[model samples]
Target chain A: MTEPKTAIAIQGLEKVYPGGFRALQPIDLEIYQGEIFALLGPNGAGKTTLINAVCGIVNLSAGQITVNGFDHCTQYRQARSCIGLVPQELTTDAFETVWNTVSFSRGLFGKSANPALIESILKRLSLWDKKDNQIRMLSGGMKRRVMIAKALSHEPQVLFLDEPTAGVDVELRKSMWDQVHELRETGVTIILTTHYIEEAEEMADRVGVIHKGKLLLVEEKNKLMKQLGKKEMVFELQHPLETVPPELCGKNISLAAGGSQLVFTYDTLQEDNGVTDVLDCLKAHHILYRDISTRQSSLEEIFVDLVRAS
Target chain B: MNFQGIKAIYRFEMSRTFRTLGQSIASPVLSTVLYFVVFGSAIGSRINDINGVSYGAFIVPGLIMMTVLSQSVANASFGIYFPRFAGTIYELLSAPLSFVEVLMGYVGAAATKSFVIGIIILFTAGFFVPLEVKHPIWMVAFLALTCVTFSLLGFIIGIWADGFEKLQLIPLLVITPLAFLGGSFYSIDMLPELWRKISLANPVVYLISGFRWSFYEHSDVHLSVSIAMIALFLTVGFAIIAWIFKTGYRLKN
Candidate 1:
């Protein structure tokens, strides 16, 4: 299969609303085929705006987007035909049956009716039994699943899930992630925007962090953690200290648990890590510890720092 | 170009019409029949004829025009409006649907709905008044034209409006009143000279008059002018819709 490697490319993309609101700054991003790319951003960080721009739902102020090597503006139909967007809003035809709604979405992409394909999708989403049920009658989770089914009905190579699990229950979220992984295995490139740091940690091959209308960084999951991660060493002090000693005050050290523990934070990427020097300094300062434990920073910590710093 | 896409949207809208039969079909039909009963029997008995034609028969074309105009606009405006309201418009926008295809599906289904109601109202009016068409072909032509034209107007209204009240604004404050004054109940010819002069300015006048001409070959305006007005409305409506699509107004951003 000589399929293109770049599933979607955004170059110098910018969006400025008429009211002088700059929703997105000029940015460049590329999502490859068959990769789970997670976009992490807090509210109003342009995560949805970026996704919408590529989906052609939001008009771009500048730059160009190409999906499957088709220009999103000049070659709109082809570019759009390659994308399936599961919008943040849980919107569906309230009166329509699940089967007809999904089938209709497929047809909108110019695909001929294929009941077998539609049936398989419904079955896969665990919605086969409720296929005849009106959308209004389905539970919230089922409705979201139907949205996913409708998006996939067209069989687009790239799927954009904007906050797919926003209001879903934990179990539903887990099942949804499982379904996403299954879809990824079948060669669908999934790009999801989420506030759940654990989701990115668990699901993304590559993670992009955006803040205040700018994409701060895009990196492999492990690489991001390694590059920016830190480890904290906590020493259970033999005696509670009312204050830090003068000599140990300059380093990445702090007293925690109301002075019951002395915490030393160090960069994981640094070679020395300074754990030995810290212990020696602590020993020399008559700072005795009962025990010591080290823990690496989670993705959530890194994400918070990245956004907070910017 | 995307025939399947158009069909899917069209079928979905048509199915919604069926599902809400009372609101979509029955309400308009029943309302128009009520109009025929009150105006045709009550008003017609008081005023025997308007220019030689029986009042009951004379008001038929106008009544049909009234029902068709409002129904077409109401059907189409709400057809597109509901999708926007429910936010499912994102599905259509993000899909591979061209603006034309989306418009075709929505406008086509809406026109068909109103056309069906128009025919039903025509038949319902027939029971109230003994009707005859001097030019049956022109009658059908005007019926289809008015359905499509007003439906386009409704489509425009759907895009232009943001609130539920705005959707009903033009249909009620503008369209209904225009229809009443546009010679739906009495001809502009029957109005005082000053009022008649002002009445010609109402766009609905041409629509109802042209439609009436096809009934008894009698109209306030010349048949050619009536045809011209229909063509003008169709052209302008098409242009505005094309502009909306091109600019992606209300659909994209």
Candidate 2:
């Protein structure tokens, strides 16, 4: 398949803090335009550090980052102007009205004040009603929406949300996911970092797994699930068996419930998948089965296995 | 470059000042008025005159300088420091502005505040005693210079400070004390011998002396030296701020 246009290009980025903690280790990745790329990692897995480095908040120890073809270091204003970041912390100015705070963010990027655009952004985030309210007066979810409004105020090409739904309730998280999908429809390349595996499964087009400052893998979400996701087929046997039938003994097969059932694990990516072969072997051994069932492992299971192995 | 970015910070700081008018404007203006009422009248009744100017008039320029210096430091420092303390500086750090533009915005707002306050004190002093400015141009020059210079100093202090106490520490312990001893209330000529030389070493002395000279045509130091000292201090302040941004000291890793 032809590669999509690159929105953000990170080349050999490395960050070793002053105290010698390597926050990121030579992470080289490219995020395509209009795709929801989720950097999924556990706590202390350098997700925040990586986002901070790209946003130019945390200075990178080494490497180059180009945002929309502009070198981040050499042309910072042009590069940073194309990106917006909603930090993990809710760090709004408490006394500022929602309208002013969002306007301030737009002004920070050298953009002329466009009240109508800011109003539209707030309205889209369902925060237009609270435009005159002080940030301190809003609830946690409103403040988060205000953050998103501020990030979108400047009309950036790429939006980086560091754990956007971290502390949100289930209902709010779903709404936020819907908002993210809407943003993607508007042609904003959204890169979010989250430890919520289900969030990645729900929202991301591509997923990257980072652990111990190292980026282990980056792949299309559906492709990753298909490649690593294993399927288990269980056979309900009518009679107990001492062990797996000799015909299927050495295969990716096993017995369960004290031989009352036979379990065979297979990869979906494989053309044969051993489904037909397992049934033939069971019949050849005279192991009668009342019924059969198969189940596919989820992305969560694949993610856990990848992290554990690394 | 990035004029809008500079204006954003400048306008934000200015708005904060207006929002906290009680602490930022009213408090300083009230204290300066109290100083004029107490020192101008009480001392004017006794000393009568200093270097051919009435005691009340002689202290006018001094009072304005003192208030401007301290307010400049306090305002600029709090303007930047509070954002850092509140964790909102990430927005600034991640903005498209260069460090110079940011400085222009913050220091510009701070200096404007102190300048306005200094003018208020100067006008209030006129009501207490008859005043005449020997050179109004130089008077305005000194007032503006003092405001800008001290605001720059405060911006540096804000970046260097990590905690709230440290922010208040410099203005309270260092700036306030320096203004008190820097000949704001008395001329260095009044000090006998040893103390006179000691007072000369205070950098704030040059600021007050130059400003006083503009009003009464009398100063302890030569005009050239005072102008040179102010210039030197301004250059140093810019150099330090540039270094802070270059090294990303206490701002970024």
Index of the highest-DockQ prediction: 1
lDDT of 2 by residue, B171-191 (tens): 888888889998888899999
Q: Clashes in model 2: which pairs? A: none
**Model 1 Cα lDDT, one tens digit per residue, B1-253:** 8899999989988998989899998998898888888988877878868777899899999988998899899989998999899999888888777777888898899889988988888888888888988998999999999999999999999999999999999999999999999999888988899999999999999999999999988999999999999999999999999999888899877
Off by over 4 Å in 2: A1-3, A234-264, A276-293
lDDT of 2 by residue, A223-278 (tens): 99889999999888888788776678777888889879888999888897778887
Best by lDDT: 1
Candidate 1 structure quality by residue, lDDT tens digits, A1-310: 7864999999999999878999999989999999999999999999999999999888899999999999998889899999999999899988889999999999999999999999999999999999999999999999999999999999999999999998999999999999999999999999999988988888999999999889999999999999899889999999999888888888888899999999899997778888889989988989899999999899999999999999
Q: Whole-model lDDT, candidate 1? A: 0.92
TM-score of chain A of each: 0.96, 0.90
